[model samples]
Target chain A: MGKDQILVRVRDLHKVFHRGSERIDVLQGLNLEVPRGDFLAFMGPSGSGKTTLLNLIAGLDRPTQGAIDVDGQRIDQMSEADLARWRARHTGFVFQLYNLLPVLTAERNVELPLLLTPLSRAERKRHVQTALSVVGLADRAQHYPRQLSGGQEQRVAIARAIVADPTLLLCDEPTGDLDRKSEDEILDLLQALHREYGKTVLMVTHDPHAAARAQRILYLNKGTLSAEPIE
Target chain B: MRFWPLLWSSLWRKKVRTTFTLLSILVAFLLYGYLAAVNKGFSLGINTGADRLFLRHKVSLSILLPESYLGRIGATPGVVDVVHATWFAGIYQEPKNIFPQLPVDPERYLRLYPEFLLPEDQKQAWFADRTGAVAGRTLVEKFGWRIGDRIPLVSPWRKQDGTSTWEFTLRGIYDGAAEATDTRQFLFHYDYFEEARMFGKGMVGWYIIRIHDPKRAAEMAQRLDSNFANSFHETKTMTEKALVQGFARQIGDIGTIIGAILTAVFFTILLVAGNTMMQSVRERTAELAVLKTIGFSNHLVLTLVLTESLLLAGLGGVVGLGLAYWAIERGDPTGGVLPVFFFPPNDIVLGGVIMVALGLATGILPALQAMRLRVVDAIRRA
Candidate 1:
């Protein structure tokens, strides 16, 4: 069925900035698409526009020119407020650094986005508990971000992202700041979630092993994108 | 997510800075409360008064008005009644124990000012007995003066030939029924003072006039002045509040001055709070940038930072207002010279407004700064 339709489409997206009156282009006419339930990794060198492209798709920044459609909503045409509401309802993001609020308990961090929804406190807590359990850190739900190990913290971040039950999960170098064991554990969790939950996953990573988990891979080089199948 | 916990915990992250900012806010609000109270006190019952007016010499208060002017003013249209008064400028035997004296016509005075609760019999006794004097409850308590005790008052306006010369019998103790009226004054019959043949005789300092209708006060005042306008002595008519304000007026434009002080204080607080918020947002730049990348908008990041600023300023305002309430409520039992020493409900409301203003002012720049940050750049900041 046409690969069950496209979940996200980026067409002729371009991003430029001025550095002291000089035009500096980060992404030039880059086009990409992700099918439903696809696990894709974007790989590139520094300044290859990998992160830039991810940001554009995430609607975190406005491109000088282009159109991005996620689930039939032309996000590039949406107001900042509409985009925020859409992100709140539909996207889960994990970062290289665990960006959990340090003052909140792990459970509270996971419960953040759920607050924006109509879920009751009891339901939110239930979801938080289940997500933390899925992360194998149910015992650590009461701990602050500072009290958790790097891997534990990232696991908490992952739990927070998924607790909202979003359609898509975006991870940027999720294993880049971890030790080998932590990296392996994260990769295992990501693979399990992709296999069992059927969540569409997109990851930006330098770790070949991390990318190996993806169903497909995309290479971004100096403001351009190329699709490639995983080995 | 609910913004309140996010706002609250944001401040908890910088404990020292938050505490200091709160202290600064507390001090600023405390000052604001005191200044507002002073402005209120200075104009208290006078500005809105219903039953009183002062009849003083047009030229100056220090200059005396002829006692004869009382008859004409009392007879003026819409004039309910009138009484004569002069600042006796009397001294209690000791320099430290000072009390103001007014040589008043007891009969007309008691009839005019019902705010002073004194028995009609005692007032009559004071009038009949030439040496009799009446003291307010505050003066009686402060100096331990008893009724029927013979006390000597040294006159500042007209000193006796002898050092310890002036003498009078204390006949009645009076209490002011309202805050606007002074409870520290000593009143003796003008007849008694005239009997002593004291200086400034036949010439009273001012007149207290009560009118039939308060609404016609301005009109009656004009009539009273016009009656004496071309006469040998010119008179000025004003409400008792204006008279009281006149006394407080020697200190200059208190309202304008107080406004300037409050502005300066609020501006200083704004700068202080702004700097604090700026630093807070700068420190959290990476975190906020991350929030943005996760689909939190620039507006949301701005809102978070602004909410933190508001929380800080609001908490500070509440703290400061509480302190002011305690200080003023715990002050002098006898109504300290600054009698209207109250952190009024309006002042609390004003503090609330200030807190809101400060919060908005302090938050805007930090919020804008956070909003303008490049997500990629912030994540890479060392």
Candidate 2:
């Protein structure tokens, strides 16, 4: 694929964490390239650095050594404030636990990302309504997180992620906290977002069933990626 | 401005804790308001006529000076007129009903203190009747007294007839021209008091001298004191403001006392409010991380936290001061003890500034903590 078609590129990535004086290498000499509209999944054990790699690409974190370019921008070299602005403009995140503000209604939670924009209040409200409708949660807009079921909460979270129309959709075990039925529903929604909107998607998951739904799956072990599934 | 709702909702996240914290702030500011009013009342006399001087006994306010010195003071250069008043130390029926009762030459005292607004007809009546007295409007309201009423007071100093009771006809009720003027005094003719008193004849408490040019008051005061330098009753002379301030200092340094008390109260409030903000931020750690994930910069998070704290403090302060204003309007609850009991406009402005400062002080640490939170670590902990 052409360089312009590659939405995320990680070259010679290395991440090390320290606890007191001990050094822990989470990801070392890892490389990755995810093309636009590709649905990619990183499968690994709990300490295999799947989330770390995803965070570096999302500009939520910086690598110990490497280059992370997202949508042609060198995010690894960006300052914290610039990274924040870049993330707001180009990335959407869906968390496993549906980290919606308990004090805000579903509509308000969905409208969170739009507050950074200079959009009029009426325009923001319309955009929030459209995003909630896309996630099949338009009817539940006024309900608070406590009033919604786990699946519904995740749907609201998805609406919030897409409300800004970011270029890359990142999910970190988006269905990890749901029942099997709700898990399938979230996975289907992720699939629909990728297939219909042609959005670049990157997800980290340990579940084989969830990995099976992605267009490409890479297993991480010993701080490196492999095409073969982990035994 | 769009973040206001978010800040407000976050402030009330834990309703019980937020409510109790708000109440604590309210009570602190309420105490602040009342104490400020009390301090203003105690210092009210200091703001009176600057062009006037007081000539009193060199020893103490309780020591009497010869009444003959009033004429000498009035004859001095730059001295326009002079009046003398003696403290009666009298109470009406009960010691709790004690208020200032001064014996003065009615006409001269009225001329010296034009701020005491007495009707011309009543002034004539008071001058015509030797046993007539005039009560301030505040005193009249407190005792429900009216003109033509017989009022009796018991003085600590017994009369020549071995009786402590003194009777006078209420000829008038005088109002104050300014809000800060003391309207809790009872003024009676000095002739009646001097003729009936057992001792201290031909003596007065203090002489109030009105001068032509206030700029020359100090020089005139020095000149008057020299006139009695080596006499049997040596005199100490000072401007009216200084005399009132000296009297206040004799009781206590009211400003320092009020400052110390307010400092203690606000310090305790800062701790309470700071702890509350910290707890609120701690509970929202994961939520804050989510915000960061959605592109909220550290600076934005810090601003949100600080704004939340300011909103809480400002709300409590405004409400507390409003309640204090209402209570002051209902009048002083201490009977007639505090003569000038209204909250000063400057103090209200100071209260507003303190509220903002309190908000920032209580919020800084927690805001820094929120700002320094690493999104990855915070989410993992959550």
Scored by TM-score, the top model is 2
What CAPRI grade goes to candidate 2? medium
Q: Candidate 2 — which pairs collide?
A: none
Tens digits of per-residue lDDT, candidate 2, B122-240, equal 99999999999999998999899989999999998789999999999999999999878888889999998999899889999999999999888789889999999989999999998
TM-score of each: 0.82, 0.88
Give the number of the best model, judged by DockQ.
2
**Reference A-B contact fraction recovered by candidate 2:** 0.67
DockQ score of candidate 1? 0.44
lDDT of 1 by residue, A27-91 (tens): 99989889988899999887777777777677666888999988888888888788788888888
The clash numbers for all candidates, in the given order, read 1, 0
Q: DockQ of all candidates, in order? A: 0.44, 0.70
Each candidate's fnat: 0.43, 0.67
